[model samples]
Every structure is written in structure tokens, then in C-alpha cells.
Target: MEVLQILHMNKGNDETSYAQNSKVQRKILSVVKPIIDEAVQKMLCSNIAPIGSMGIADLGCSSGPNTLLLISEIIDAIHATSSCSTSFTEFRVFLNDLFSNDFNTIFMSLPAFYNQLKEEKGAGFGSFFISAVPGSFYGRLFPAKSLHFVHSSSSLHWLSQVPPGLDCQAAGKALNKGKIYISKTSPQCVLEAYSLQFHKDFLLFLKSRAEEIVGGGRMVLSLIGRSSSDPSTQESCYQWELLAHALMSMVSEVNT
Candidate 1:
């Protein structure tokens, strides 16, 4: 299956929806809030031409409370640092995610989000214009030099697709059989394929963003990672290991 067609989090307010199960992601966002604030402040205070209108892009902005929470944090940082001389009067906010993301859920929540912004920031707090841009961030999704600040959290570990030759059909056999990701038992070839895919995807991401972000723009990206260099380390692939085990167990039960 194509990853983009099926890679979204469970949608709506169901028990298994990403909206209900994203506490860890929220914690990660909170932990990185200070870094986001610092980056926004520096972007604003830099000695560049005065910005009357600012462009901010939140890449991989999944649906839920955290989506608007991130926007609110950024706005708060801007409000705190804005002086009469350096105040921005207009904001162009872009929320980006994959084509299959639960964007409708986010859209349904916008009325309350706008109301809260109005109540807290007041009538004179400037204009916020938000739009969603749907696509992969591994490639270009915005016009050249159109963005000033970019933020992404709890995303970017996703490759554009599964690593090449790891598939059963491509390899003519099940390479890394019974596993969904790199594992201690995965052969050297499986590890190399994943690493190569990551490098290729990441480099494309940087090149795409380079065309979209202005000269002095700032980006804050927080992603899942580990300190260990080994790709098969438990710290790096344990979650997938457990998931694979569960899936294999289900398969065995079905066959039995």
C-alpha cells in the first residue's frame, strides 16, 4: 500500500484516535516550548527589515488540541516580544500534514480557537489568517521565500516510504521477515536500506524548506530519536519490535 494513502492517525474522537492518545506528544511539545519561544524571539529581534506581516508554517501539524496549542504558544511568544516599533499586524499561518490526515477535525475546532484568540488577545491583537497545505514535507509544499518561521513536533521520523528492497516482492523473499522495522535480527542489508532512505528523505526535506523559508527564517523540529548509534538498539526500535510481535501473534492465531 502507498504510505501516503494509509499513514494517517486514527481519525475523529474515537477511543483509539490520535487525539485521545497523544499525551506523550503533548509532553514533548511542552518540553520543547522554551526552545520554540527562543527561536521565535530571535527571528523577530533580528536586524532585518521590519516585518508588518509574518508567515509561519507548522509542518506535520496533526489534528487535535495540540494543533491549536502550538499556534497559541507561538502567538504568545510573539506577543510577549513585540514592542510598539516592532509589532506585527498580520499573520499568515499554514498548517501542513499528509493528504490523509484528519484535517476536517481540526477545521471543526477552528471556531472556538478563533474565539479564544479574540477573547484573550482582544480586538487589536492583529489578524491571523490560517490555511491548510496538505502534502509530504519531504518535498516542496510552499512557494519560494514565503515563510518566516517553521515548527514541527513529534513528526519527521516518517520516511517518504518504506525502505527500498525491504518488501517481500522487491527482495523476492521476506527480508527482515516478521518485523516492521529495523531489529537485531535484521540483516546488514536491511539496516543499510533504512539508513539510506532516511538520508535521502531528510536531504530532500532540507532542500525543499530552503526554497520556502526566508533568509533569516527559523525552524524548530522535534522528532523521536535515540542517543545510540546502532539502528537495531532497543531504544531505537523497541516500540516497533513490540508491535511486530503482536502482529505476528495475531497472524498465528488466524492460521491456527
Candidate 2:
């Protein structure tokens, strides 16, 4: 199956949905708030003129409370920095994600979100136009040189697709058998395939963003990462290992 076509977080407000289980993502946003603030601050302080309408995009913005939290934080930073000026009056906020994402849930929450914004930022608060753009961030999604500030959190580690040749059907056998992600026991080819995919996807991501982001635009991206040079390091792959183990146990029970 095509990963992009099938991949998306659980939808809705149910107990198993991403909206209910995204506390880790929320924490990630909190950890990166200062960096986001710093980027917005620098963007405002820059010489980019005609600041009446600022374009901002949160790529891979999964549906959840954290989806709007980033926008709120950006608005807060702008308010703090532009208190003395009226130059920044309009906001064009883009929330982007995969095609299968639960955009309806996000849209349903917009009315209340706007109300909160109005109540907190006051009547004089600048107008914002928020729209959802569904697609992969590995390619261009916005008009050329349109975005000023880009923010992505807890999302970039997702490659554009599964690394080539690792698919069991295509490879004639399971390459990284019994494991969904890199592990210490993963073969050299499996490791290299994943690494190559990441590098390729990341390069495309940067190139696409470069075309969409203005000359002085800033991007802040946060994702699960490893400190060591090894891709199979426990810091990065341990979660996947645990998940794989759980899945294997389920398969064993089914077979029995």
C-alpha cells in the first residue's frame, strides 16, 4: 500500500484517536515554543516589508489540540513583538497534512478557535484566514515565495515513503523481517535503505520549502531524533522495537 494514501493518525475525539492521545506531541510543541518564538521575532524584526499580510504554514499539522496551539503561540509572539505597530494586521495561516488526515475535525473546531482568538486578542486583533491544505510536505504546497514563517513539530521523521526494496513482496522475502523499523538486528541493507530514504526525502522537503518560502523566511522543524550517528540506536528505535514486539505477540496469538 502507498504509505501516503494509507497513513494518518486516528481521527475524532475518541479515546484511541490522535486528538485524545497526543499529549506527547503537545509536550514537543511546548519544548519548541521558544525556538518558534525566536523565529517569529526574527521574522518581524527583519527588513521584509509590506507586512500587512503575513503567510505562515504548519506542515504535517495533524488534527489535534496541538494543531491550533502552534498558531496561537505565533499570534502571541507577534502580539508581544508588534504591540507598538499596526503593520502586521492580517494573517494567512495554512495547516497542512496528508490526504487522509482528519481535516473535518480541525474544521469543526475553527468556530470556537476563532472565538477564543477574538476574546483573548481583543477586537483590534488582526484578522487571520486559516485554511487546511492536504498533501505531503515532501513537495511544494504553497504559492511561490508566499510563506514567511514555517513551523513543523513531531512530523518530519516520517519519510515520504517506505524505503525502496524493503517491501517483502517486492524483495521476494522480508528484508527487515518481523520489525517495522530499524533495530539492532536489522540487516545492513535495511539500515542503508532507510537512511537513503530519509536523506532523499529531506532534500526534497528543503527544496520544496525553498520554493514556497520567501527570501527571509524561517522554518522550525522538530521530530524524534537520535543523538548518535547510528540509525539503529536505542534512542531512536526503541519505541519501534516495543511496538513491533506488541504486534508480533498479537500475530502469535492469532496464529495459535
State the lDDT at 222 in candidate 1. Answer: 94
Write model 1 residue lDDT over 94-149, tens digit each, in one string: 99999999999999999999999999989788899999999999999999888899
- Residue-level lDDT for 76 in candidate 1: 93
TM-score of each: 0.94, 0.94
lDDT of 1 at 51: 50
Model 1 vs. true fold: TM: 0.94
Q: What are the per-residue Cα lDDT tens digits for candidate 2 across 31-86?
A: 99999888888877876665468899999998989999988999998888884335
Candidate 1 residue 21 C-alpha distance from true site, Å: 0.4
| Each candidate structure's count of clashing pairs | 0, 0
TM-score of 2: 0.94
